[model samples]
Target: MSTQFLKLVQATRVPPLMGPKKRAASTAEHASPLGAYLLDARAISPGNLAKALALQLREDARLGDILIANGWVTERDLMMALSAQYGIGFADTALPPHDLDMIRSVPWELCLQYTVVPWSQTGGMLILATSNPDKIPQIRAALPPGLGNVLFTLAPEVEVLKAIALGHGKALARRAEAKVPERMSCRNWATSLSSLVVPTLCIVLIFNLLFHTTMTLAVLSLLACALLISNVIFKGTALWFHLTEDKSEFHSHRDHGSQTKRPIISLFVPLFKEPRIAGPLVQRMARLDYPRELLDICLIVEEHDIETRMALARAAIPSWFRVIVVPDGTPRTKPRAMNYALNFARGSIVGVYDAEDAPEARQLHAVANRFAIAPKKVVCLQGRLDYYNPRQNWVSRCFTIEYATWFRLFLPAIKRMGLAVPLGGTTLFFRRDVLRELGGWDAHNVTEDADLGIRLARLGYETEMVDITTHEEANAATWPWVKQRSRWNKGYFMTWVVHNRQPIQLLRDLGLRKWLGFHMMFLGMILNAALAPLLWSTVVVAFGMHHPIMTLLPEWAVWPMALVFTLATVLTITLALVACRASHLRFLRLWVPLTLPYFQLTTLSTYKALFETVRKPFYWDKTEHGAFGGAEHDVQTPEAAGIERKPVIFGTPIKDTAPNIQALPDQLTKVPVIKVGTDGTIRRIS
Candidate 1:
């Protein structure tokens, strides 16, 4: 054998042969013992044989096939060895066709699985050809009753695989056909009618019955007041719990002592249209601190997104990162693409990120550590999301404030209070098994993240908050912001409708408190957005026109209505201020007074979302990122922007450093002093 072949055989572990033995009396003793004979004849090395045996222990392939695949030994070498050792003739592929009865004796599934085929049968003996001839005894045991003596012959692995494919084509097709329907079925009409149509009809009927505008205004005001108060109560409770709760308890402290045992993490980044950020996105992912070998990062791109594909091709993506092309399907939504990629995921823990996301480098490590320490019922973790481009424009600034308030204050409060956390769209990690059990993402739900969060609660699984940040682009433009918010509102509508299809069942599953929380979070948010403009209009019209609308209301209702509106406004402003302080965006405090006007923008999206909910419930209004320049412009930190950092105390960061500093005693305070350390440990030098 050539030196190259020998080296190849050494690497592949082709079996060695033993010294020839005296002819055995029993036929069982003659069953293909070519490996030992080859070793004895110096056709293969002992070390190679040991290696092949070690590989065989771990895999389901035969030794000969392994050697052939590795280019260590030829088929002819194996054929000659088998003939000499077994004292049996090779079965020619050109032999006459076997009877159909003989062929049907072994099932096609068995043929495909074992890579064996029944070639011919003669007089109480069935001749079988297999790449793994040594497995004849096992194959015979699997044959149907009434089959007699089984004879085996060796065939090349490639030829065997080809024959199996040809013979089992129909069976394979049937198996494939069984899976397509599940992926294709995306719509759920029962949810549509109950969630959208009935609600609309009820609203119209109530408005028509009232007839007069005064009664309608009173009822709308009352409904809006109730929603506002309920939100205040919920938020107040969350803030209270957040303040009192020992947040350190939620942090996982488990050390990753063993590198080998670290679980594989599958990250799915669903990309569409915005190809300009692909290279940067890949670079950001590559910067993750997790072991590259254990990270299965899949960039899910739609089949029709040629520009993104080309962009990715041009980017210097690492070998481990995969670009999975999602096949064209209904809804063409992010969740649909995610669901498709879930099948190809090869990790125990799965995470999702967006194209523009730049998650904290240690996020995967934190997620894995949390999962390791979390209870089995805790199946998901949502990381905090904030905008890096908050200073881009007014819209972006307001958007960041809203996000910071929700993520930093509201979400933590929700988690601390033990309510379901309506998950954010990205930087969410899930237990792979749990995600699959929940059927992954609902392709037809535009806001699949929130829907999935509710589903997790309904199924008795908990989603915890991971203390990591994933910075993404804040929508800086009007139309794009409206479209994105509309999709979210629409998805929330779908989730509420779908889960409420069987109200009693949902209530039973989630219990009364969670059921109520679900409504207040999903339904109440929608109500707040939709009713914001109407309520603001009432206040504006009543104040500006000297009580034009207020005059129509009953004399007794006017004072109470005014008081309710005043209280709601004060509480909302307080919440915004607190949320801003908690989120370390004290700069947003200046904009807190403009909360009403900021929320008025939401009305546009709410109405648009309502229409879309009725007309095209599953339409995904894609939020195009990279619009406000690139990642570099979007990832600005507050400290980098010359903003002073404050220490967090009791879930709220201090607003000013000035208050903590005491003026030096009159004699020693003559000279100016500067602060240096984070703890405010000052060094004064004159």
Candidate 2:
């Protein structure tokens, strides 16, 4: 899988390799050369030739050969057209004087089929002769034999699926759409039982107590349950839609909507204590194809962390790059440092990446090109993020699958619905000034990206997708991953609080549809993150403890309710795996089943994070990131110095949950970097 396939399919006209105004030759560009026969359009019809032309994957293929192979156009018509254009009779596919490069470049199939006008031939000479007569004459003059060709021509419109079908055959096209039933996630399921979904039983109980009529309460509870059921249905639908790949852009009518300027992009990398990730981070950043002068790649560090600062200063980076230091004492979370960087950033577009991420090279280019052609109304593009070390262990595999579903399937579907997309923690690009207009990152909010996206949509900017994906380091072990997820889960809960704090304003800004979507996204994350685990564990307990779920119910209702719950629980988990693609049966044997129980740690960790959020606001757990390198790691602390790690920085974490999070002082509980103002004024909060 060379990424070139995706590149060719979705490429937009990029500025020249060197500058902003010059354009590169795109997949759609046409070609012309002298000393070759000129194939005329009259020789064949586009529709008839299109079928055969599709077989030739090569960009340079003979137009006449493809049309002839497809059997829609005639060799007589092509020869006549070529003779008229080049003043020579149509001859066998031969390299005319001065057309050697053109012939070799053209697909062999196109030459054989068009130049010889054959009905059939050996599978050799792979090329699709198209209906375009102009291309056929060129192929005759340019191409040589031995290259097999398939006949084809451009159609009025191509069904991408149709082309895929031609390559894969009828069996695949007839394959059934997935129908997996959702089931409980984790096998043991303790945390899931206690937390997450506020139980349906709780709803029934509330109805009984609040209204005091058994029948009435039952009916009311059923109605509430119906609403919950509907919510679940909608969530499933949302998740389903994103699984497909789409490149259409969101647009609007505007005066200054021309796609001329190549937006200046600011890349932000939020660095914490994980110095082992520096090399990967730097490499990913450097690998980006975006012009160096146009890119503002910032390696953000805390002012108090001498280690991170030293590593950054010593790292080789472009002069356009910078190390922004936030003061050590205000908001300890990542969002705070981003906010500090936002004020000084000078790019039209802004993006955020984690210290351990290595995004695909074309992401920035994709974002830019997508924006250029997209409906000018969108203000942000969310690229996908997956695990770089997904197979590191059972824990990493589960996390990777979960992330795959979220980023690949869930997020894209949400974007399609025109809802407020949750800005992922990384691979998010935004219009810089739009971010500032909405008041930069929320210094107080832990999940700044999600909150900012919501606020931006509310403030009249739209969010869309570039459909680009990137890779990030997966938490190597269960405990560490849980700790990290717990923090994120807690931050999402906080995001809900801040937005709902002013319900009236929210309603006015987002309107009902958007407001509903936002509520679902916000509450959905919290509820799913909570309830899925609870349900998982409960099912296990019911089966294990023989808790008499049906025995406790009324005789008439026992079977029905039990059946429904059991069915729904199963459906939920099954869908979870399918939507997420939790390894095929083969991979499952090696990766999934063994890791099932541990995956529930998400619920358990979430609960821990819930309490931690209340007890210690702005806790910054220093994620330990060196298991891959082992003793040979870089960024080691003084204590680790005697071992293999030497060049890496070991910073004092603010909310230290990992090895030394607790050691951070109360005074240094916030952000750790600061920047001097124009008058040389500096704030020493850290």
Candidate 3:
């Protein structure tokens, strides 16, 4: 069935031509015109031709389109007939060496709008390939006045489209290349100094001043306390908003009524390595409950990643899935690959998913419904993200708790308060037009998602949180987890620096409330991670070991210092539990007592991140997956890992755990079976 449909679609785009002897005989036999020639040549039957002519009279489409739609004549046959009748040559798909110069002669927009490509220029004539050769006058009119005589040649519609994508893609790539440092790279002197050099100098200066003056030590202590107080207040406010906000406004179920029509949705999955996960990724995507014809999935692979490319080739992928090979370039990152694929997206809505993501089956439908009901100013919808392998190790469990806090509590709270929401990397959907207007993702930015979210707010576009989840693999090992966290921390630092480049303008763009939120979220988070160890070390030494550092400070400062530590600890623990409850990971709340140690891990990653930012700023520290657990248990599925999927109502989980099963081909779907016990714990049904 797939083969037959593909044949028909291809036929309409580029028809198969007959042998030269047969073509000449038909042409010589029938000199009436294109339609009569096709009919006489038996390229199209009398019934199809008659039906096409009748439909052409009522519609604005060309006769060839109608004929092809009705399966009467192939686009190749039509183009051949038209070429013979008009006494023009059929353009070759092989791009010429002079193509670049010709492309520069025409505006990119005009070329795209007209479906015409400048083929070559010779002497006084500028040659062009267009399926609609009859529109030569209009095409010429759209071109700039400096060009000489315009010549038209026939080409298959597919070839013309290919040419357009190629030509426009090259132009976009050139533009992207020029802006690489500004957009993605952190090699600039300002970023380097801020991320590394300044921090080092500040630390050295603080220690020197501490040895020389008690006033300097007092000032440093007060500054640290100020940052701590601001961090606690930010968390407290977000927690209050999370608890007090009306949850009924955010619907978990899809609005079926709003989905009057299924719009094409383009899903981009950028893969680098991990051949082991390819089969699973394909199966997961295949389970998406969307009309096959309306789902455009692009598995973007780097041109050099042969292992992943081969793995995808071996997978039982559906015909609708497209593999886009990103060209080799600098700042090779996921965002760069996605930017390349953006040009080929055919959907009105575009979504990004990681290679390991397993988004809900109806995620796209829900996103579409939201888009339908939303105002034009709402350009992006960020879905919740959690780890499927949370119980795989202590690191993963802590990571999951952290994610639960950010995605379930903090992000939703910000969205509710009408503040800028820093977008998570995966499970994010955008309006195609708006995304293009914003120039897609910054190829050079490490945390393009967060950067884009801030950019959207600066440009007066709003992002809302959708009540859906995409399960991803947690970094289970300590080193890998540290690497992953370091990248994230580095990205946060970069995002802060990039957005804060024009502080006055940013302050004007985002009002005072939002501007403060942005600072607390990005810069404050960095400070928290970097300074937590220092504060913890001081407390351990002064209180735990009864050290003399406490004697250096004034007597009045001791009470306030103890109060800040107590308050911060209490607020963090309370918020962690709240986040767990909100995300249906209440069982993980047991790990709250270990939060201090968990944060210490983050401190390690933060310092590593700081160093990397100065040394290899744009380097992507790839996280390896598929290692699910430690010695206690082997690798397992989500169910085997004891994770449950539950719905949240009014920030509370209802005790129901029946999996929403959607049947698909065995080779294309692999949902793990889960069972919920009376104690509210989830276990594998096997």
10 residues in a row with least lDDT, candidate 1: 1-10
TM-score of each: 0.68, 0.55, 0.73
- Better by TM-score, candidate 3 or 1: 3
Count clashing residue pairs per candidate. 6, 74, 3
TM-score of 2: 0.55
Candidate 1, residue 538: CA error in Å?
Answer: 3.4
Model 1's TM-score against the true structure: 0.68
Candidate 2 total steric clashes? 74
lDDT string, candidate 2, 24-114, tens digits: 2211122121101121234443223322222222212244444443354555554444334322222222211122332334433343233
lDDT against the true structure, each candidate? 0.67, 0.52, 0.70
lDDT of 3 by residue, 319-341 (tens): 55788777677777888888877
Residue range 1-686, candidate 1, lDDT tens digits: 11111111111222222223332321233222445545544566543443333333333345664455444456677765665554444555544233555565778757755668776665657777776655767777887777667767666544554454345433433332222223212265434355456467658857765676665665666677678778767766876776686767555432332222347688999999968888888877776665443567999888789999999999887755888776565667888788766765657899999999888766876787777777899999988898778787888788888888788788878877777889999999999988877778777777879888988898899988878888888989988988988988888876787787778998898988888889998889888988775566666545545433455566566567677778777876777777787545888889877666777878889889888866777777888878775555433443344433322111122232132223322222232333223321122232
Clashing pairs in 1: 16-39, 17-36, 17-38, 17-39, 17-40, 18-36
Error of 3 at 491 (Å): 1.5
Better of 1 and 2 by TM-score: 1
Ranking by TM-score: 3, 1, 2
Worst-scoring 10-residue span by lDDT in model 2: 176-185
> RMSDs, each prediction?
16.7, 26.9, 13.2
Q: Which segments of model 2 are wrong by more than 4 Å? A: 1-231, 243-259, 528-556, 559-599, 626-686
